[model samples]
Target chain A: MTVAAARVPAASTPSFIGGMSRRAKVIWTRRLVLLGLVVAFEIYARFIGNPRLFSPPSAIVYALFDEILVDPRIRGAIYQAFTEVLVAYVMAIIIGLVVGLSVGWSNFGRRSFYPIVILLYAIPQVILLPLFVLTFGIGPACKIAFGVSHGIFPIIVNVVAGMRNVNALYLRSASSMGASNFDLARHVYFPHMVPSLFAGLRLGMTLTLLGVILAELYVSTGGIGYWTKLYAETFDPAPLFALIAVLAVMAILLNELVRIAERRFTRWRN
Target chain B: MNDQANFTTRSIQVAFLAIMAGVWYGLTKTGAVTPLFLPPMDIVYATFMRLVQTGQFWSAVRVTLFTIAQAWIIAVVAGLLVAYLVTRSRHWTAVMEPLIASTFAIPLTLLFPVFILFFGIGPASKVAYAATYGFFPVALITIAGLNSVDERYLRAAKSMGASSFDTFRHVLFPAAFPVILTGLRVSFFISFASVLGGETLSSAAGVGKAISLAAELMEPARMYAWIVFVIITAVSLNFIVSAIENRRREY
Candidate 1:
């Protein structure tokens, strides 16, 4: 009878309160902290902060749905930015792969050209923003070119690094077995490149986003830059905050896409 | 064989550069590309010489350097403080490190407009933006550096009757110095780039502003001149930094 009573009491305790693993608890704590920050900001903005410069979370959300999304002009600008990023990313991958392969395929190519590539990469690309504008004009073309310039370097550098590190033993054994150069490349070089190339893709996405946005903001006469400039000048912080939040979300989603692709493609490494 | 290979690579690089110069000169001199698109080399050189002699050039450079210095100071102080605090406990590290890293993954440039809203289009805005941008690398690297110190060193120091402060000072700091130095170098360049970017976007003064202004005025020669100056400075700075790092590694 005593054992039955104890079991009943133990079973009566709430499972929800007792079931969390340590990681889940930590994750919940982080979420709660973030929520707490949002709440704090909401309170400060509503009561204490300057309305012209700071808008509460609720107002920003409302503005997002009502003002920014519903407007056709703003929508087109966002679309243009998205398209620019996509095109630039594709171009960067193609060009970076070509350059990287050509320059990293042989000892002569690596030694002769890699230093020059690094030198070009070291320059502050922002310093050339104006030059880009002058060369391509202040259109989507300028933004796309700038994005490619920024994104291509990381990919090339990483591809070269990856291709250089193939095991000498593997190469010698394969060649001794009468493998052709094409066979060697397919069997050895390609496998080694997957992980490093993915890493570069992730970085390339980030830099491409940065380059496109920098061009967008610098041109201030059209696209997202114009809208941001207008909102800032007019001191309409709600729509302004909403627009920026949208861009941030888009960037995060793109980055996540690259990361997922990296994981999916590089599983052989494990 | 290795020496010959080295000589061949060196000559190839030299030849490649010579050919590029030749092509550029040939294209411009022949007017195959318009002067508006690619100014003559002599014109750009003369423009750069004239720009260097101007007081406006010096002031613009001064402003940019000053902004970079300010941003760097802010980033270092805040980054070290946060890193030290967060490293006080493993739980803190677990909670904060991912938060910092994920936030950094989002191009912080998206927030540049917000910065302008609050700080306006002055050096103040650029300072805040650059400092915020730079803080991430400093904090992340410092946290890693501090956490990576060998536990055996700490134990040895403790067994020798060393106090906690002494243990940290003698055993921990030196071991972590190289990584922390790398973090500082990275942060410096980040600050430099961010400040330049901010000025380029919307600023009243700085080298970036000068470049943009030249572009707006359709003064291609002047703009190219400013660009060449910046490229030289940036390249030289990179070399200087690597030299310093090599020296540190030797010791």
Candidate 2:
């Protein structure tokens, strides 16, 4: 009997009705909870909530098409915000990479500069928003610059960290085989730092978006900032909600794009 | 040798700051950047000294600090509560952790307008905005901390016939305290910064408002004074927080 019991398999196979995988169950439960919350919110807004201060989900959806898409200025503001974020993100990556390399390259440089970099990072950059506007004017230039300022630090930190751990033996062997400094950096350092760089890129996108939005909102003379101010002052909550939703969706999509690229580049780690 | 290396690095760091100051002085002197955009360093220092002596400056600082305090309290309480609830079961943690993290990927700054609408453009709105911003990091980190408790320790507690409350108090809380403290530190900074951002965007009062107000009036000297003060405060706070964290880590 003991031998027979030892040979028997466990009953862990998936069944049709009551044996759903934990992952699937978690997903379904999350979806249901999200749907329920939305429904509850819709009900509250339509019946009891103040229209001027709060908007129902259905009206928000309708306003996205009827109010936002119909207005050319609103469309342009959205487009400008998007363009600013793109420009800022690219600039941040390039500048961050260069600065990070130069600073993190040598022992003396890293020792002297990394603390300064971190100190600068700790200072809330938002306090300087007004100065940026004063310098660059209330244009896309100011917004892009501000965004780059916010986004670059993460990349610099990550790049330095990535470079810190390069295999000494590999460097020794490469140099013994007559590899130049440039060759060692390009071949050994770059590939090793790719994973960390991607992590920075992902975070950089989020911070860049944050910076751009802060600038857009701060300069209330034009663009999405103007519209948001106008809508809030006029108590047109629907368009305001709709506009925010669109921006949120845009942020999510951009973040997802960066994340996908990160996964693709960092596949070797897994 | 280590002490010598440290001294050299420290000297180099000091030199770097001196160079930056020199650059700023040069930039102002050369008119490469206008004094309107970057005020003269001496002028800014004088303005900062003058501002600190005034009651108005202190009031604005007090207001901003008070708002940050309120926001941080709300964030910490709500965040820990949610984290506790979510981490109670493995299933719940798996389901909610990703959801919470994904929300952070979408920049919460986009929600500032809605906050202004509901709470008005006062310190109230700023508090709400900052609280929401601070909540994410605290909740995420706390959940991670709580979940990281060793399975063997938990099993040992269970086998020793300890109650769940006793197990949590003695076993779980101690193990998780460091991470939770880190989370709180991060939350405090996030709250501080976001409140400043909210005031800068739209507010009637606070240090951020004062800076913006000065800028709007084209008073670069005053604005720079406020900015410099904030930078000093932030750096000092960072050092203080790190020291506290290090002290706690020894135990």
Candidate 3:
């Protein structure tokens, strides 16, 4: 902090002022356009685009309460998707943590399984949503399964990575003090792994949402996906837009929760 | 920390692949599971060869890759422009970075139907969605990477009589290049997934469509074959990018 602040002294010399610009002005000038672009887009969307292509913000806004909130089934499906996501996320954490530790903690296990994990992670899991629905049945189970598959890999990878580079010195020193196995794990390994676990959680949250949303859309038999398909097929963008906005709000809140948790848990780390 | 032997790491990786292939073969060959449910390794290999030989696979792949390429190009250009605009200030990166990041967290799969409705079932929809999905990470990373560059380098170049353009060309570009490249790699892979997604949802043709068609047609072996091909392709791209990235850091 001091070093960075020291540079500020030379931040406003005549020569500095000659070419230097105010950071505040630069920040505002760039950010001011965000509102401008939205205003311009609102104008274009509301006035120029095909009504089917986009609703004017006013129409879309009206649809949120009039069409979406008024429909009990749509509301139910939205809630169902939310619950499925929450459950799937918890399941993914448990499975990923166990699997990651099992493989990563042993050289032999790591050699056998990490390859499979990486290979599966690379492939686009969304492509298999239909098959997942077919196999797991076209219900929340399939969506939850798909979501777990997407969510678990990032967690496993991050957890394993966090364990791999535990400076041997810490382990050695702990053991020298006659620390028991559980004590060693608690005092050394757990603290070392905390930051990376939170990092994985952030990624896991994003992927879990993607997985659930993909499965939901693919099922076309039940849940939010069913409603989205209905709206699209019937050429009703109002309800479709409204339902999606609700989902977006859910996603934002979930992501924010994870972010807050990450901050709370990983506060000691750099 | 003990530096593990390179040969040991190499063998571990190789051994991992061997065991995986063994399990895959064992699962299918013993007839414990139905062939359609879990096709034999030889059968899948045969299907792969047939698909590749007949060139039925290329058309779908070409379309999918083309969509990804187009979207990535659009995203890179737009994201770089926006990021450069954002890097003009510190506070802008702070406020707008979160805004962009939060907007990006939305599944975006929700917007797929909207894209399909607007653009019709075509590559255009695929391109738009893929670009929209890829654009966020690119812009976010570019701004972060550029902002994180050391100020002394900029000042040093300025004191040496370099103009802003020269400073950017010589100092800023090189420093930010590695992080920006990583962003491109991330975006490209994401764009690939999203393009596949758009095509699967509604498209004239693409690899995703191939998978969907295969599944509905009940051709499990062929579906497995195509999926295996995509998995290989994705893994290889990741390997190549990581290799290039690792190599770049040395120079």
Candidate 4:
């Protein structure tokens, strides 16, 4: 009778409260501790950091909207940089697609050209930032050029890789059906490559931003680089952190946009 | 890595390089490009050999290597610990994974000035910045590795009366090892690039600084040689990493 009564109590416990494992409890507490640390950092930044070299979350929040937005030049520069990114992205996709198709369509082209692209990509193009400025002369042209150079390779590589792996059985089946070349390529090839092409797009965006930012920082006499250096040299942490936060926001938005596109296009994959 | 094939792929690579060299030689030979803008292949090759002969090139390489080593050590240790903690909870991983990845998405290069302010114009700054950047990949991959252990094996081990440590050591480690190796490979390259970048952007001495100095002094051949050296180093590192991963994948 006592054992039956004990078992009865076990059945009464709900799923919501049932079987709280020790390890899970530990993990929750640990994460709580990390979140707590972030709060503590905010507190410390507010209280301890020098206003010249560091700003609290509160100050940064205010600076970004108030001072940062109020300045037309700063806003314009940010706008210009964003536009540069967009144009470069479009150009990269077009070039990447053309090169990818051309290389993958033939055995000879793939053999000789792909390696050259890979080698060029492997080079730390950041080292050439000064030369870019020297050659392009510090306008948006240099920035766009650098961005394209960095961004296009991954797309090309991925597109080629994507197109190369289509099953021969499918191609043969299509040909056996007397499908035209245009039909085979349009229907069979492009769809197969979309997943990898998107993957390359994501990577290309990352590299493009890296390049644009590097160029901006090197030019130092104009654009975002000018402000960053000015703030760094002058010991004004408020505007520095604020400006960085703005750029960070831009990067996040761009990435999120790409990720959504990736998800949308890759739905047919799984 | 996803699409590497056999000798057919390599032949294309070889032919492409030959054609590139031919173009370079032809252009310089025909004066389509000046020696100042694009030096003769022989001159560049000789300069590269000379750089290798000098102790200065080795010293620069050593400095760069040292920075990467220090950064990677910190990143691996910190990342593993954090990942271990994160994997203990589904909720925490859900909350923090996106946050961490997003933070990584922001080019840490933007924060170099801050690192410089804190650490100064030296290896300390480079090491710190590289480690900060390197930490993201390591931690992200570790989380991925730990979270995606094969459930069947885990359950089988549990049924067989294996302890948590045994499950972790035998099942989890091996399962995640390949992915973690990829993360390590990525971190290594990221560290290498960032370290070089730091030196170029602001540093007292390093290969990056050497390249800048060469450029500033208008020595195109030497600068080209330095670039060639960097390309070789990056590619070889990439090759070694993939080779290790490939061999390990077999087992």
Candidate with best lDDT: 2
The TM-score-based order of candidates, best leading, equals 2, 1, 3, 4
Clashing pairs in 1: none
Mind giving the per-residue lDDT tens digits that candidate 1 earns over B134-187?
897788777788878887998899999998778767987788888777778778
**Candidate 1 ranges beyond 4 A from true positions:** A1-20, A178-182, B157-167
iRMSD of all candidate structures: 14.9, 12.5, 8.9, 14.3
Q: Which ten residues in a row have the lowest lDDT in candidate 1 chain B?
A: B88-97
Give the number of the best model, judged by TM-score. 2
For model 4, what is the alpha-carbon lDDT of residue B178?
70
TM-score of 4: 0.86
Which regions of candidate 4 fall more than 4 Å away from where they truly are? Answer: A1-38, A106-116, A176-180, A268-270, B1-11, B53-55, B155-167
Deviation in angstroms for A220 in model 2?
A: 0.8
Give fnat (model 3): 0.45
Compare candidates 2 and 4 on TM-score and give the better one: 2
Give one digit per residue, the lDDT tens place, for model 4 in A1-270: 011111111111112232457445645765786788767867888788666666777777888888888899999888988988888888888898888888887666776677777667666677776567656778999999888888888888888788788887888898899989888889888888887777788777877887788777767778988888777777777788888878878887997788789889889878
For residue B169, model 4's alpha carbon misses the true position, in angstroms, by 4.0
Model 3, which residues run further than 4 Å from truth?
A1-41, A106-116, A268-270, B1-12, B160-163
List all candidate RMSDs to the true structure: 9.0, 7.5, 5.9, 9.0
In candidate 3, the residue pairs with backbone N, CA or C atoms under 3 Å apart (3 or more residues apart, or in different chains) clash, namely none
Assign candidate 1 its CAPRI class.
acceptable
Query: Rank by lDDT, descending?
Result: 2, 1, 3, 4
Candidate 2 lDDT, A1-270, residue by residue in tens = 011111111111112243458768877888988898889989999999998988889999999999998999999999999999999999999999999998888777788788888888889999999999998999999999999999998888878878887887887899999999899889888889887777777778888999999999999999999999999988899999999999999998998888778778878878
* Per-model TM-score on C-alpha atoms: 0.93, 0.94, 0.88, 0.86
Against the native chain B, each candidate's TM-score is 0.94, 0.95, 0.90, 0.89
Model 2 chain A: weakest 10-residue lDDT segment is A1-10
